[model samples]
Target: MAKNDGKVIAQNKKANHDYFIEETFEAGLVLQGTEIKSIRAGRVNLKDSFATIRQGEAYINNMHISPYEQGNRFNHEPTRARKLLLHRKQIDKLIGESKQAGYSIVPLKVYIKNGFAKVLIGLGKGKKKYDKREDLKQKQAKRDMDRAIKDR
Candidate 1:
């Protein structure tokens, strides 16, 4: 029998539009029971979400995990900082890279791998207004090409 992989609860498309991702890494999330239940129900959002290396560890911020309907006072906070599990070497690399000029780490996507929740974090740099315009133009051009080919 095939094992069940934890499904992708949500993704942050805005993160890609606002930043030019340089690299990406996957990290495990430390989630509670209710939070996992909520995620399985498709009650999660990654919009406006980001990650930061604080003190000596990394944490995800601004991610909204809707409170479990069945959970009363045991519900987790929707916007609380969630710890990200990464190796020491990886954390060090992230910290150094983040301190470099114009570099940041943002949560790109969240999905289940095996039975654990995993987050795809990107090392990114903020995009200028002109860069965004250029990206938009490129996307439009690609779409037009696809349409022309389909019509042929």
Candidate 2:
């Protein structure tokens, strides 16, 4: 129906606090049977997950997908380097940008779109301590303003 319309499975909230995202791209995940079942069961974690381009392909590392409860010995590993399905142009752009100083590819969020798992990856640069502080201050100020308005 709408862009990115699906049930969100997991999110890496720390990525925003530690980096300033420059751009975002949606890529589909190449998951196994048990992995998909685990994801649909809400047994996935995006914490500390990141994206990387290698050999003209993209992969997501450190993502955890708990084994399906009913799965037998064929269960997938909890954390694995899974392939990411991205366009060649997109991968090339990500590769070029990631080669720059202080740039990284981070997984922002994961969701199921049209019965397929998709990950939202972001190109981000590390935020300086002062930048993070400023962001905190701005957020606090916005909250204060909203509270004041509500009281009026």
- Best by the TM-score measure: 2
What is the alpha-carbon lDDT of model 1 when measured against the actual structure? 0.87
RMSD of 2: 1.8
The reply for model 1, stretches above 4 Å from the true place, is 1-6
Local distance difference test, each candidate: 0.87, 0.90
Q: What is the lDDT of residue 119 in candidate 1?
A: 86
Predicted structure with the largest lDDT when compared to the true one? 2
**Collision pairs in model 1:** none
List where candidate 2 sits over 4 angstroms from the true fold. none
Candidate 1 residue-wise lDDT, 1-152, digit = tens: 11224576788898888999888888899997699888878888998888998899999999999999999897899999999998898899899899988888988878877767888888999999999999999999999999999999
Supply candidate 1's per-residue lDDT for 113: 79
Clashing pairs in 2: none
* Residues 1-152, model 2: lDDT tens digits: 11578899998999999999989889999988789988998988888888888789999999999999999998888998999998888899899999999999999888998999999999999999999999999999999999999999
Q: Tell me the lDDT of model 2 at 76.
A: 88
